[model samples]
Target: MKNDVKIRNEMLSWYDAHARVLPWRSKPSERPDPYYVWLSEVMLQQTTVQAVVPYFEKFISIWPTVHDLASATQDDVLREWAGLGYYSRARNLYKCAQAIVSEHDGIFPNSVKTLKSLSGIGDYTSAAIASIAFDIPSVVIDGNVERVISRLHRIDAPLPDSKTIIREYAQNLFIGDNTDRPSCFAQSLMDLGATICTPKSPKCEICPISKYCVAFEHCDAQVYPKKRKKSKIPEKYGVAYIYVHDGKVGIEKRPEKGMLAGMVGFPTSEWNEDSVDNIDDDMSAYKIRHVFTHFALTLYPQIINQKTYNMIEFKEVDKIGLPTLFKKVWNMIESDL
Candidate 1:
């Protein structure tokens, strides 16, 4: 326990000196804003810092406050979030903002419990907002935190299952009694894990808390935070109808409750588990490919007759909103048309 305190102090001091000057970092005289913290957290999920920086800046520039976000149209919100992927995050972000507007009068909640009640906020996100935005002494355990804790204690259990144990360990090391800087502390741990104590080839020589890191001492820091094996993503095949009539293109809204829900895409059928032999008869044009972290989707781009429409909407493809995945499909059609 004493060692933990020592390590925490060392990490905090190092963080004070070396923390990255990110847009979200609060100035000495400025208080952390829950809205910015929440936005950054949601954008950073399963995304890299470099990839999220521009999007974060753009969002802040456009909305500027929770009330602004709440007032923005859903289409505008989704359009801004288009390239960010994870359409669900964008949808949930709008939902959360609306909830704040309706229930909390556009003010972010201060406690983890209340924050969790908002759409898309889970345990990690709630803790992050509570600690960073409100300085509430809550433990914010992200993937970086998990890595740092697992290495410090030389924990070898597979992650997700080991997350709770690691969170408890971090909770024990909290310096709430000495400082009202939980935000900096949490950010410091994240920076340390990301920059120095990385998952692969950790730079222990430059690490401030390496003296107390159990995994470092044991020469196994690289492998301490073990993870479960990833399951193979099954390949899938589908047909997309890129029907163009006059100067407009046909597009459809995905079902409201599945993958890529509520996003605009070319009309497509349910993906088949097996590779399709041919879609030439049913499609005017077709293409095949795979997406990262998802199954392979073959798009059978078909130019349908104008008389076949019943529920589909037609618009100038460039004028309508489209998710990145479908945007790629549109590009393919543009090359051919």
Candidate 2:
């Protein structure tokens, strides 16, 4: 057997004995449920596993199946998915559930090509769902897998640019394993990168496949997945106008396009790169800052003795689907009330 085959076998064997027991993952003896797989994969995008656990449990508990989720209102879904940033995923999750129920008769498509056609199921997500849930042969490469591949081959190219090379390298691992469990093989790579071959200070000593890792041999595993220098993130300024009446706060749905699109938030001024911060001494309650993927936002909360027709009870704020940025602003202003 080739070195790649040896590495693959060792990785899967390590995974079988030490796989992280996540709620959505099926036991080794059982096949995974496609709905749970798709839902967990969607929730895990750009979000940490710790943050996604409660949200995943809540969503699965409330909407047990695709059909149940399809019947749920978009507002309810968003509410349940609050705090797990990337609100568009919640929107797409609803649409995908509906599509699965109506288009595919409530059954998740087992093929990568078919899964890709679903809303929000991109190339990576589709591969993940096809391989993990259905036991199909598919190349699943996320950030973790990319790091592992880059280190294993000592690929020096910077990320985003090196992604194609890393993916091709990862693809070879799952190519001829007809008898092996492809799902375990794919997930093991992910888990290995997550736990052992981490981006920073990787626990190389305990890494199962460290013998085959080119970067590890050279003592440069941390530097394998080189990344381009990020451009300075621009800062945007805005004011969140908090209105309270009868113990309810004013919240409105943002426009269905642009930042925080279609999510619930307090009324605010435009978040512009050059926007001036017009904070009055009496009106300004607090200033809060949040960093997004592309930009940093500074929001000045101005409390008013006025009320808008749109009001949600302050005690019920947890039930409303407020994005992380808005939630931070709310926490700052809520203390004043």
Candidate 3:
């Protein structure tokens, strides 16, 4: 066998024994469920596997199929997806499920073009669902795969710039096509990258493809996938109002567009750079600090005792969906009550 074939075989063999038993994955010989694959891939974007597992299980338990998910209200979907961050994914997920039912007759599209036409399915997600669920041979490159391929070939370029070459190298693994079960090979690379070829402190000694890895041969495998430094994120200050009346609390649904779209949260003044140190009130003691991908937020939580029309039972506020930012405010105050 050629070197690449040998490496592929080794990877498949390793995957057979050590594949991560995720709720969404199937054994090498079994066919994967497309709905599960699509849902899991969508949830996995900008989320860690460990963090996504429970959410995946919850979603599967609540909405077993695409049709069931499509039937759910957007508010219901966003409620379950509350703490998952990236509220946009939850919105798109609802839209995509409805599209799959309406546009494709509840069957996920097998081709990349058709899949990408859906709400949130893009290049990576489309390729992943196509290959893993439909057994269509395609290159599926994610962050983990990027790291593994960059190190294996010792690509000198930094991320984003190196992604093109990394994907090209990854495509080389699917050389033998369906006869080789390239779908399994795709997952094997994912398993290898996720478990063995990690970003930090890679376990080179136990890696199945170490022999073929250029960076490993040179003793600098961990440094193969280089990255540019990120600029410091800016800071924003805001104040959230926790209005209380007889036995209820005030709540608001954010605008359909902006930072935390469609998610439930306390009403708040617009975020700015000013500090809340001057605005002294008893409820200001519960300060909330949250960090998003673009900026950090410091929220001064003010609990005002006033009757408001849009109110829910204060005791039942925990049942509704609130983003992590507002959840922090609830956590601090809930402890007192």
* Root-mean-square deviation (CA) per prediction: 2.9, 1.8, 2.0
lDDT of 2 by residue, 112-148 (tens): 9999998899989999998899888888888988888
Best by TM-score: 2
User: Which pairs clash in model 1?
Assistant: 240-300, 284-302
TM-score, one value per model: 0.90, 0.95, 0.95
In model 1, the Cα lDDT at residue 230 comes to: 86
Model 1, TM vs. native = 0.90
In model 2, the Cα lDDT at residue 128 comes to: 93
TM-score attained by model 3: 0.95
Model 2 regions lying over 4 Å from their true place:
177-179, 275-277, 280-283
The count of backbone overlaps in candidate 2 is: 0
* Model 3 alpha-carbon drift over 4 Å, by segment: 175-179, 280-283
Clash counts per candidate, in order, are 2, 0, 0
| lDDT, residue 104, candidate 1 | 95
lDDT of 3 by residue, 245-277 (tens): 788889999999999999889999988766665
Candidate 3 shows a clash count of: 0
What C-alpha lDDT do the candidate models reach, one value each? 0.81, 0.86, 0.86
